[model samples]
Target: MALATSRFLPVLDCPDPRGLAAFYRDLLGWQVTQDSDDWVELSRDGYLALAFQLAPQFVPRAWPAEGVHSHIDVFVDDLDDAEREALRLGALRVDHPPTPQKFRVYRDPAGHHFCLCTT
Candidate 1:
């Protein structure tokens, strides 16, 4: 018999799961399937899933730092266009600018870092 393994769902740790979920909801145009103070789940196309869990001791990842547990990669159609859109949506540009490779790093309003890459 073969063992059944659970699929992977990217889980982000933050002080407020609902707030972070809302940010992602707006950013990715995903609908919130489940939401609460401690946890929130967002879904798109019924497959891609993103979740957030509350961490009272949640210390935001200090990327470009010594060591960090994890980071997220977001793919976009156009790096430059996406960067501008993110800026308009209250995301701060942590890096200088997008390269020809079509990726840029930015931090959300709450300071959670994520990348915007061309798809």
Candidate 2:
């Protein structure tokens, strides 16, 4: 009984996809699954995919904004327990969030939104 069983991927719009993809590739040691001037995808087995899309008019959003909205998408067997543990560990739950399926949103200490999903 899960809301979504699809793989989670976070797509980010950037001025330079190749450059940002390179940065994340080196940072995470994830293999570059796809690469191009317009788009780049980096992924590691058992982890979410990181996608960078080139957008000439892309502008960075302020903190707490969704311009780079990304959820690390941690999967677990128990959503309730995981959400509770996340709250206990200092993650602030988002009230009346917007998203499809059964997922919970929370803001990290830095005010970035992420999702806790079960599949």
Give lDDT: candidate 1, residue 88: 78
Residues 2-95, model 2: lDDT tens digits: 7776776778777788876765565346799998889899989847688988887865445454455454566666768877777766677765
TM-score of 2: 0.49
lDDT measured at residue 41 in model 2 versus the true structure, 0 to 100: 96
- lDDT tens readout by residue for model 1, 1-119: 96686767888888888888888888889999988889899999888899999887876667677455566788888777777777878888787553746777788866778889876
Relative to the true structure, how large is the alpha-carbon lDDT of every model? 0.80, 0.68
lDDT of 1 at 33: 90
Off by over 4 Å in 2: 1-6, 64-119
Span of ten consecutive residues with least summed lDDT in model 1: 61-70
TM per candidate comes to 0.83, 0.49
